[model samples]
Target: MNSKIQNDIKELVEEQVISKEIAASIENYYKSKKGDTPNRLFTVFAVLGSTLVGLGIILILAHNWDSFSRSIKTVFAFTPLIIGQLIVGYTIIKKKNITWREASGVFLFFAVGSSIALVSQIYNIPGNFSSYMLTWVLLCAPLIYLLKSNALAILHIVFVTSYACSFGYFNGNNTPWMYLVLLAVMMPYYYQLLKNKKIHNITSIFNWLIPLSAVIVLGTFVKKSEELGFLMYVILFGLLYNIGKIPFFDNQKLRRNGYLILGSLGTIYMLLLTSFEWLWKDILRHEIIINSQEFYVSVVLLLVTLGVLIFSYSKKRIQNFNLFQYVFVMFTIIFFLGVSGSIISIILINLLTLILGVMAIKIGADKFHFGILNYGLLIITALIVCRFFDTNMSFVLRGLLFVSVGVGFFLTNYMMLKKQKGKIE
Candidate 1:
């Protein structure tokens, strides 16, 4: 605590406004709180600084790589790896410091990757990006548990997810189930961190990374069953949203809650895309079904989503019973109706979007949260902007519509500000 604050507490005690006991407690509370802030900040900077230093080393080597003889190139490749391993081993055995742990972990992570790249380049190995990432992540995986480094764990997930996307999604091949095995490698360390109740930035990083990785890697599971893939995506998003609402994650900031953010945005984007009639037409026109592994996965995901939705609704756990909450049901209905070639599906989808925006505005107004209100307005504005591309609408009508919507935006905001001022007065 600062001297001024200490003096202020003493003054309160002298004036008999607070007891000596209370003043002492306040001073102790502030002292402890102030102490933790710096350690957390230092941990953040140490990891980032180490990451930059490691990357710099790799960049310097890459630049000078072509000028070196093959033997020297091989020596340089293993040099960082050996040096990083020594640092990390020393950190684990002797230092056991946060800064050392993070710095060494980061350096070792990059060392592993750069070493693999150098070796591949020297041997002229015909490996793809996916193989390169997989090798690096596997080599780095043991560091997570051995060094007990959460940052390295995060790096492992990131590189592995990248590998999955590059190999499976981009290459149009099924992602090997080995992805699950690699993820499981980090789970023991993840559980240990959670058990320790470490509410640091590392915890938040895991919360965001794991869900995001799942979302990306799940796409690779889809193959010939492209049509059923929409169902899979909906189920995946619903499950993510529900998972984010768990007691452990729900208390976190919205940005840190990856599942909630990704699920909501993904659901909204999908709904908006399907709001167009052409997509529904295409689905009905090509009514093909392939009972592949993707089909089974979709069914399982759908069942899980259905269970979660029912439980949440029954328990009244869904705080925001907005359009996002009901989107899965709405989409399922629309999918069936559209399959039968009904134009009503298109109409209902548009109506749902309109209702979502309006309800968002109502909720925002009730709560007096302008950010939420503006978000609702932005959604409506996005819908309007999209309509500008419609050939069926005349250019004059579109221009007039834009002007009217702009006026509404300005007028509504003005009214809200006036109401806020009135409330203050």
Candidate 2:
């Protein structure tokens, strides 16, 4: 009887009698008890510890405002910076395991270096702000190597870039060489961050900040001449478009998006540049303008660069191109060729606007996107309405034009929505 019961149990097990729900519960039970590390507690301690240290430093500095002599205070000011350097040196020599305490200490040293520089500036030191900032950044660089503190390195880079923008570029030289130097200094940290992809947010922040600083600093180089400035915009947009077209950049959402944002801003600035009178009258008028090779070279480079970018981004799947971008590029070339003030200029501009509006509607069939199309339609409609204003048209005919446009807007948008719904279904 015992053998028979055992055989029956084995047969039942072999016949898949157990439920999937029971197997899942068993798996989860094993997983929950595998490890008991307290990750959250460590994170809380890190935040609280950094905040307390920052507050303590602030209080100490505030309390010692007026006690020391000029020379004595200056020496004391360098004391923390010296001590911080020692700590960084010790970390490197020991090559010991790093803990949260060590990381906090490195961060504190960074603050000390910054504080020393700030105090020097407050006391009317002879150094320039950029020089002082460069000193602080150099002093903090050791912390990255010794403690492997990405945060401190990143903070130092941020301070350096801010210093450059405020002081280095403030004079409006807008030299591209400054941008090249800044990027060089940042390249090391960028490489380090890429190795450890966990700090994605930090890397993304630098990606945006670096490009923005470049654009701002480069703005000074853009001459007041509208033709020159617009040509620069074309070059800027072409660079951005080429960057966007790279296959490796496809998955980099932040980097790609940053390029798009910069390109859009450059495009808008170009449009405004076109409408400026100084570009047409002041720069393009005299024989001197025609004689200058720089003017012609700038114009040709803009056109050639834009053509390359457009050709590169054109792919089989990309059926809709940005009409505004194309219009801006074409207008820039034609204007440079000396056809800007002719009667055909107005007609071309109006056509460009209408085409862009239609392209916007095709790409984003939403109410907000339709506004571009509506705006273009309104401009054309206004022109036609104005033609009938002076001489022969009756009130009824004038009113009919207004009514017709309003109806056209409603019907076109409704049809777009209908098409969208049909696609969804």
Candidate 3:
């Protein structure tokens, strides 16, 4: 058991709420539970070792590749693929070991890539990096189910996203619709992993990769209307933030909660950037259309976001009034105000930031959470820094503002800590 639980149990015993024997039994059960869990080191090394072996084999073959005949090179290319397939197939049919499954899946994954790369090099095949990644990821995707491997699933997500970036952003492809198809193909396996609760470290991988893929691929869906893109992002962030609020992901680590982190950061950053007059001026120059593909996408996302919001509201899942929980409403108002040429939008944006900072401080103080308190202070400091960049602000005034905010930070933190200490005593 962790220290907190151990202390609680000890207190229970002292209060005569439970006997010492019961506390000892609970501790022994936790000890046995810890012993029963698998060592993650083996799983880590399995993936690492298989990857290195695959790379080493490729390097060794490459060294003598120039001397080999076409037939020999072809044989060499297919050998790893054949061997990997056999290993994976055998692991699927007979092996129940997670380490074995992961090691074999990873080995086979690289083997397929190497085999394809070597064959392409030998035959002088013409293909882009995006197509290559797409092919590799699709081929490896089945291993997630066949081997039941979360490690391979993580790798698959990384490559699939890399393919989207390569195809859409780097290649500037006009028809990037294939990315959506491929992304959809991978979702079933992700859901399977979620259903089985097999994810551990892989959860962090998903948290980072999914948001990154969305950021990369969402641009591909934009056709003519760029302004609608902002609306799309607002809905997107709202959806992500709500997903993170779901019960399964609610209590995970900060990094593991990518939806909340990315959504909140994206919303705040977009709001801050939009607070400037030039952005609104540019938007006013365009003929705002309500019938574009971007518009449809935005509307669809908005509806989904609203659905989640309503569901969350009904469930009382959003007890805390964090910035992420309410930025969608704030952004919608700000957008309308900006379009109408009202200075009130900018004022509202600034006010929203200040309110968020103050709320964070209040919540942090109530919970005795130093991170939340610092985050609130950081938001205020960020606003001050943003103000310093404006040509309209005098250097002297900016300096005074910074000094004043700095003093507030110090005093507020000092007072909170004093209060917390007093409570402890």
Task: Give TM per candidate.
Answer: 0.84, 0.61, 0.86
lDDT for residue 273 in candidate 3, whole number 0-100: 71
Expressed as tens digits, the lDDT of each residue in 215-328 for candidate 2 is 664444543443454455556664554444444343476343455556544554454444433445655443335444346646665666566555655654234455544554
Sort the predicted structures by lDDT, highest score first: 3, 1, 2
Cα-lDDT of candidate 1: 0.79
Per-residue lDDT of model 1, residues 1-425, tens digit only: 89999999989999999998999899999999887554766888989988898888888988887899999999999999999999998998895777778779999899888888889989898988887888888888888877777778888888888888888877656565778899898888877776675476677778778878988888788777677777678778878877777656667666677777777667766767777777767664456474687778877887888787788778877776556666777777777787778888877877777777777677768767787677677777777776566548988888898898788778777888889889999
How much is the lDDT of residue 14 in candidate 3? Answer: 93
Report how far residue 175 has shifted in candidate 1, in Å: 2.4
* Alpha-carbon RMSD of each model: 3.4, 9.4, 3.8
Which candidate leads in TM-score?
Answer: 3
lDDT (Cα) of model 2: 0.55
Q: For model 2, name the residue pairs that clash.
A: none
Query: Local distance difference test, per candidate?
Result: 0.79, 0.55, 0.79
- Any runs in candidate 1 off by more than 4 Å, and if so which? 2-8, 19-41, 59-73, 123-126, 184-202, 245-252, 313-316, 395-400, 414-425
In order of TM-score, best first, we have: 3, 1, 2
